[model samples]
Target: MTQRIRELLDGAVADLEPGVSDPVAAVVRRGRAARRRSVLAAALVVALLGGGLAAGRQLVTTAREPAPAGPAELGRPPVPRVVGRTVVAGAMRLPIPDGWTAVENDPSRPCGDLHRTILLVVTGNRGCQNASVEVYGSERTYPGGTLVGDDLLDEDHRIVTPPVAMTLRGGEPAWMSESLEAADLAPDRYPEFAFWNVVTLPWSMVMLQLRDDGPAERKILDSIVTTPTEAGVLALPDSARSVSLTTPDAKGRNLPAGAARTKDQRTVAAVIALLRAQSDVVDDSAACADPGRPRAAVSLESATPTMVVITLGGGCQEAVSSAGGRVRLSDATLAQLKTLLGIGAR
Candidate 1:
């Protein structure tokens, strides 16, 4: 192929000899230049994909926050430029080097774009991740909802690395693991990324596909920073301060959403007290599992909430909790409790 191209170019150059300064020499110089370019291009690819510069990576910057800027390269899905010395991915704030940039997005879409850039995943998938240097937030959280952690261990990937846990400089938790779920793409293609990572926060999580768990990766991992709201965590219900219940939006009923909420101190204390009492009557979870109609939940809030579920008038006329095995409620007690909370029939 090279010989044929050279012969054609050499002839063309010879035909334009009058204008061409040393046609034979010119062809030779052009051929050499093209060869050098091809060699350099191949080398760049190998360096980018082969080892990710994970070993000799010494890029650590503390420049001011980057201002929004245009694409670094001109093309579709333009290359993300390292606009600042610092990067804000999901919940992490880490130093970025001169050559690299981040391609940030939620987990709802596949994360297989731009091998050269880091894939930052915020929020988390419902279950395990299929190690694609990426995992996603839950379907209920991130946009698009198509790509998630449970995608699968398909042919697009055949490697698995054991999961590990680590903490950032300030004490935020992080994690990563390989998945083995049956992705719907059993034998086909999916738009989202074919790779993954994992982490969990009070309401959401943040993750990055590391070139390796070495210093280059650690620099980013060590500087994670986020509040629960920043991580998109849902606010928790204050079970200790209030007694609350939810009911189906049944047709013909006049009740509204959150109709069963109370902050009455005595009522809250009474509900908590009843749940804490132990009884000889053992409750069958299977029987209580389908407790129909009226149900109640009373919580004692703290760093963690203690909650109890109750059945009113059903065969499973009892209240149960993790701390209290089973406290069967007598008919009189049930009636008194109903009067206290003002919960009515469906």
Candidate 2:
């Protein structure tokens, strides 16, 4: 797994430790995209506890909680520093305006609804969402994941407003947008945040919960100028200085266990360009899709496989990755990839 992905899911192991109240089966079902992390967590448990159900039970019995929140808290700032009385989320800085109290979601319990949270700064908090949920981008794989296709659409299937242009941390293109509509909201409880900043690409929607027709409300809104977090990237890593293609043999039957290295510069450039340019994942059934088959598997000894192109039926460039990320390549980019792998033609 990539360092970023590992960091995102590092807490998952503790979430499954014996006496967490949440069952193993439940965590598995929810972590469809977290298969790797779950496996690693299991192996670590076996290695640490000597691989016995009885030992696992003993650990659970003595453990008061699934995991403590101290470690994460210690790593984070006690409070984000504010400048000019404005808090910028993309900067990971919180602006506490008078009565507002800013708090980061617990690493283990990120998806849970905030309790009495005034101003919140969400960083790398993601989860599977079904039914009605208060969080933004819940339907997507995660921030900067899943293809936005032609336009950004809301969970209601309604077309969201065009995205406000932004940049990724790498200075790559990205967007910001609104999330839940007021109608999509469940009953408002304590810490019921009135605003949310979600990240999706191509075009993004931005939603504000507070009404602004009233003069005072507009004044309040204008007082605190903020921006959403910069998008994450699926681009290939520099460590991936070499590339290889694993494919089936002459009969097109028994695929070899080993991969052959490709020294062709065109092929290398194409692969890197495709990965660098890509920023989408797809699952559209039939609505305007470009499709392509993965003729060969990529073997990058240096970098973790962040994403792989999937058959999206929309474009040959679309792909799904190990981290559930989707990337859409251009027709030319797809053509280059196809040629390098000897898919259709070189």
The prediction achieving the highest TM-score against the true structure is 2
What is candidate 2's lDDT per residue for 116-210, written digit by digit as tens? 23322233332321111111211121122111112112221211112222223322222222212222222342123333333322111111223
Predicted candidate 1 versus true structure: per-residue lDDT over 1-346, tens digit per residue: 3353334335433423111111010000111222333434323332432222211111121122321121111111111123366554333455554575555443455533454455433322212222223322211110100111121122111111112223344333333231112132222333344322233221222224443323333444545553211111112222354544432233412123312445555555454443333353542222232212344444343223333444444455554442223455665654444444565632
Count backbone clashes in candidate 2: 20
RMSD of each: 29.4, 16.9
Assess every candidate by TM-score. 0.28, 0.29
Quote the lDDT for 334 in model 1.
Answer: 46
Q: Ten residues in a row with the worst lDDT in model 1?
A: 22-31
Which candidate gets the maximum lDDT versus the true structure? 1
Backbone collision count in every prediction? 16, 20
Off by over 4 Å in 1: 1-239, 245-254, 257-259, 278-280, 283-288, 291-294, 322-324, 342-346
